[model samples]
Target chain A: MDKKKRIVIQSIATLLQNANLKGFFTGKIYTGQSKGVCVPGLNCYSCPGAIGACPLGSLQNALSAYKFKLPYYVVGLLLFFGTLLGRLICGFLCPFGFLQDLLHRIPFPVKLKHFRLDKYLRYLKYILLVVLVIVLPICVKMTPFFCKYLCPSGTLAGILLSFRNSALFQAYGKLFTWKVIVLAVILVAGVMIARPFCKYLCPLGAIYGPLNKVSLYRMECDASKCISCGKCSAVCEMCVDPTKDANSAECIRCLQCVHECPTKALRAGIKSKPETSKPSHEGEKVPEGRMRGKD
Target chain B: MRRIGTIICFGISFLLIALGILDHQFQAVLAKAAKVCLECIGIG
Candidate 1:
C-alpha cells in the first residue's frame, strides 16, 4: 500500500468497534505476551484490544500524592518518544490526529491567524498539561482529572463499556457529567476549527513540541536550493512557519511541507545542518501555496 | 545512537502497551496491587 494511504487507513481505524473488556476481568491475566509498550499517541484506552497505556492517565496516577509512585517507566517512555519524534506520532500514529485530518478534508474551512486570539489560546494547553494532567492528580488522589474532566476518549470508551452494564450507568454521577461537558466542547470544536483540541489543549503535544528542533527526524528547508514561496506556510494546518522554522515547536511534523513545496525545495525527514544561522534574506515572500502532493 | 534511540522507542512503546494489556486483563489484581503498592512502584 502507498505510504499516505496507509496513514489514512490507520487514522480511520480509530472509529471502529473497539469495546474495552478489561474491566470485566477480576483475576490475573498476565500471559507474558504482547508488545509491552505504551503508544505515544492519543489513542482511546477504552478501545478494545488496546495494548498500550494512556500516558496522560498514567501521569495523573503517578503524581497522586506528595510522595507519589508508579514505575517511572511509562513517563520515561513518553519523554523518550516525544523527544525522539515530537508530534510525528500524531502525524503518523494517533487515531485522534487522524480524525482531525479527516475533518480538515471537509470543504468549508476557516484558517486561523497566528498573531490573534489563537496565540493566547495556545497557552491553554500548557495550563491544561500542567494543572489538569499534572497538578490536580498530585493534589486530588481520587480520580483522573483529564479523563473525568476533559478527555473524549473516556466517552468513547464509556459508550462501549457502560452501555453493557446498567450498574455502570448508576455508578456514573458528577464524574460522568463533567466528562460529557468536556466531550461536548471537543466535539463542538472539531466542527468549528480543523483541530481545536489538538491546537489548543493536548498535553502530549505540549510535551513533544519543544523537542522538534532537536529531534532526529524533522522537516528541513533547503535555503541553498532557492525560492521562498510561502505556499508551505499557507498549506500548513498547524499555522507553522515552514521555511523560517520548519521543525519549530508549532510544527506537528506533518508532510504538508513536502506536499506543498512547488520548488521541490522543501523536504521532510531529517535535519541537514545546524539551524542557528539566520536567513540572509528575511522579507522575500513566495506564492501562498503549492498544491497536489498529499500521497 | 540513532539506531539505539529508535530501538528504545520501539521497545518502550511495546512495553507500555504490554503493561496496559496486563492491567486490563488483570484489572482486579493491578487495582489491588495499586491499593497496597500505590507509592511502592513509584506510581502515586
Candidate 2:
C-alpha cells in the first residue's frame, strides 16, 4: 500500500470538510451557501464543520418533500457522479472509506476474507439502498429513513457535535443510542474486516456499483504481459480479481492491483476499445492490434 | 446491444439532469442548507 499517498489524500478530504475549526468548537454546522452543493463522498451534512451536503441526506430530504416537489438537484448530482467515476469516489474520496482503511491498518488478523458468506453479504448494500434510502422515504412521507435510522456517518457527526455541547449528548434517546451502537460495532469490525460497511451496508456504494460497468474510466489487464502470477489479486483489498474481471462492481478502483502488478499488465483510463478478457491458458500469446489507445 | 442500452441510459439521465437545472431546484437545496438539520445532529 502507498501509505503516504493515501494519508495525504485522506488529510486533504478531512480538511476540505472541516475547514472551519471554529464551527467545530462552536457546535455549529456550516450553514453557508456552499452547504447546498453536495460533496461526492460520505461525510455527514450535520457535522459541525462540514461545508457541503451529503448526497444520501440530500436524496432523502428531496424524496421526503416529493409530495410538494421534485428532488431534481440531488438526483442530477448523483447521476453525474455515478456516470463519471462510480465507486472510484469510495476508493479515493470518501471520509468513511478512509476511516475504514485506517482502522484495518491497526495490526490484526483481518479475518472476514475467508468467510464464504461475505460474498453473498455484499449484496446487502443494494437492498439497503432500495429499501432504506429510496422506498422508506417515499412510503413514510418526510422521514429521512437512512439518515435517521442507519447512518453511522451522521452518528459520528453527532458525536463530534456533542463534544462542544454536552446537551447534544444528554438529548440522546433510544434512536440515538441505537445508531451509536451500530457505529461502534462497525468501527470495531473495521479492524478485522476490510470496509465492512462499504461491502455490506453503504447505500452510496450500492448506487455507484452499477456505474462501474458503464463509467468512462475503465481498468484493463494486458493479457500479453500478464504472467498469471496472482500478485494483483493478492494485493487488492476490495477482493477484485483484476485479471478475470477488472470492471467488477466490487472494484473500488483503488489502483493497488495496478501498482502491485510486476508485469505492468494493468491499466486504467478512458479509451476507445473494449477490454479483452484474460486468456484461459497462461502460455498462449494474445493476438496483436486489437487494443486501441485514446481517441 | 448492451453498449447501446448504456448509451441510451446516459442520454436519459443527462436530459433529466438538464431539466432539473432548468427548473432551478438548487433554490430548494439552498433553503435547506440555511438551517441546521436537527435530526441529523441527533438532537430531537
Candidate 3:
C-alpha cells in the first residue's frame, strides 16, 4: 500500500476503535458490551473515547489474575490476530504507531535512520514482553507492570481524559509525572527516528514480529523477477532486506519496500501454496547470480 | 504445507477462543474493561 492509503486505514482504525464519542464529552470511559472485545491495535481501554480493549493491556490484566485462571481469552485473541495479519496491525491499525508515523513526518534536521546500538536495542521489546507483560504479572501480586509503568498509549489516554476531568488531573501523582516524561521522550524520539517505540519497546510488536514468518498474510519475494538493485532495502525504514528475508520478524508490512522494488519482485498477501524450488542436478554447481542484494 | 500451517493456527486460535468463552473468561474481560483501569491511567 502507498503512504496515503496506509495513513487513511490507520486513521479509520484508530477512530473506529475509539468510537465512544459521548464518553469523550462526558469524561467517562465506555462501559458497554463492546468493551469486552479486543481491538487489533494498542488502544487503551481506559481512554474516554475507547470502545474496545487493548490486547496487551488485557493480556497483562489476565496474567495478573493467573491465580484465578489462565488468560485464555486474551492469548487466543492475540494468536488469532498474529496468525492472520502479523505486524500489519502495527503498520495500519495501531493509534500510537500512527502517532509515531505522524511525528516522524515532521521535518527534522537530523533523521537517525540507523545507529550502531540499533540492532541490540531491538531485543528490548522481547525482554519487556517476557518480563513485564508476562512474568511479572504472574509472579508478582498480579500487577500489570507494563500498563502501570510504561504504556505511552495508556499515558496518552490519561492525559487526554484529564483535559476534561479535573478530578483525574488532581489525582495525578509522581507516577503520572514519570509516565508523562516517558511519553514525551518517546514522542521526541519518534520525531527523530521512525517508530522508535515499535522498534525497541512495544511488547505487542514483539508478539507479532516472529509470527510474520508464518502468518496467513505474508510477504513473498520472487527470485526470478529480482534484479538485486537494492531498492527495497534502501527504502525500508525498518532496516529489513526484503529480497533476503521477505518475511523477517522486523518487517511491519508497511509495503514501502514492495512499492519501491524496481522489479516488482516483492509481494504481500495470503499465500495458498508452499514455496517450490527448481531441482538441481547431482554434483552440478550453480553459478552465483545477483538475485538477492546485501543489507 | 504453508496453507496447512495457516489453517492449523486458525483452528487452534478459534478453539482457544471458544474454550475461553465457555470458561466465562469473556465475562471476566468485560468486567475488567468496563471499569476505569486505574493502573493503566497511572492513577494507582
Candidates sorted on DockQ, descending: 3, 2, 1
Q: Per-model C-alpha lDDT, please?
A: 0.59, 0.79, 0.86
| Residue A276 miss distance in model 2 (angstroms) | 11
Per-residue CA lDDT of model 1 for A146-248, tens digit only, reads: 6556777656555544555555556666656666677777765675576777888888888887756556576667664436778888877788877777667
After superposing candidate 1, which stretches have Cα over 4 Å from the reference? A1-9, A12-36, A65-67, A107-115, A271-295, B1-44
Chain A TM-score for candidate 1 is 0.79
Reference-based TM-score, model 3: 0.93
**Per-residue lDDT over A217-245 for candidate 3, one digit per residue giving the tens place of the 0 to 100 score:** 88887676666789988889899998888
**CAPRI tier of model 3:** medium
Off by over 4 Å in 2: A66-68, A271-285, A288-295, B1-13
Which of the two, 1 or 3, has more DockQ? 3
Q: Give the docking tier of candidate 1.
A: incorrect
Among these predictions, the greatest lDDT belongs to 3
Which candidate's TM-score is highest? 3
What DockQ was computed for model 1? 0.09
Provide interface RMSD per model, one decimal.
Answer: 9.5, 3.2, 3.1
Q: What is the lDDT of residue A277 in candidate 2?
A: 45
For candidate 2, what is the TM-score?
0.90
